[model samples]
Target: GLSLEPILLALCEWGQHHADELNEMDRLADCIIRPRQARQPAIA
Candidate 1:
């Protein structure tokens, strides 16, 4: 059987390199959406 270790390792490396940028974008999205969401009424 072929091993997936190499594929996973490459993905991990890619994520590590972009982690900061990814986190920053997530933070920005939360900041932007949360406040706006708070002002809106939720539909049940």
Candidate 2:
């Protein structure tokens, strides 16, 4: 429906505006996750 189109577009624009903030959060999350992933012994 047309109603959802505006809402979806607004949400997409908002995400674009906050792209850097989102990427920073992703980097922080990866820092937390990567160490745990690295700790596991390799399955050679």
Candidate 3:
């Protein structure tokens, strides 16, 4: 199996440096995902 700690740390550092872009992407992803989530029934 692959070790994820270093990968996640790198990603965190990258995110810190590129938060604005990440936020924009998150907003875009939410726009795309929300509609599908809305159409689906809530299940627990």
| Highest TM-score scorer | 2
Q: Which portions of model 3 show Cα errors greater than 4 Å?
A: 20-44
Better of 1 and 2 by lDDT: 2
**Who wins the lDDT comparison?**
2
Tens-digit lDDT string for candidate 3 (1-44): 13555676677666655766656545332211111223667799
Give one digit per residue, the lDDT tens place, for model 1 in 1-44: 13555675676666555766667534332211111223567799
- Listed in order, each prediction's TM-score against the native is 0.39, 0.41, 0.38
lDDT score at residue 29, model 3, on the 0-100 scale:
20
Clash count, one per candidate:
0, 0, 0
Ranking by TM-score: 2, 1, 3
For candidate 3, the TM-score is 0.38
Q: What does the lDDT come to for candidate 2?
A: 0.51
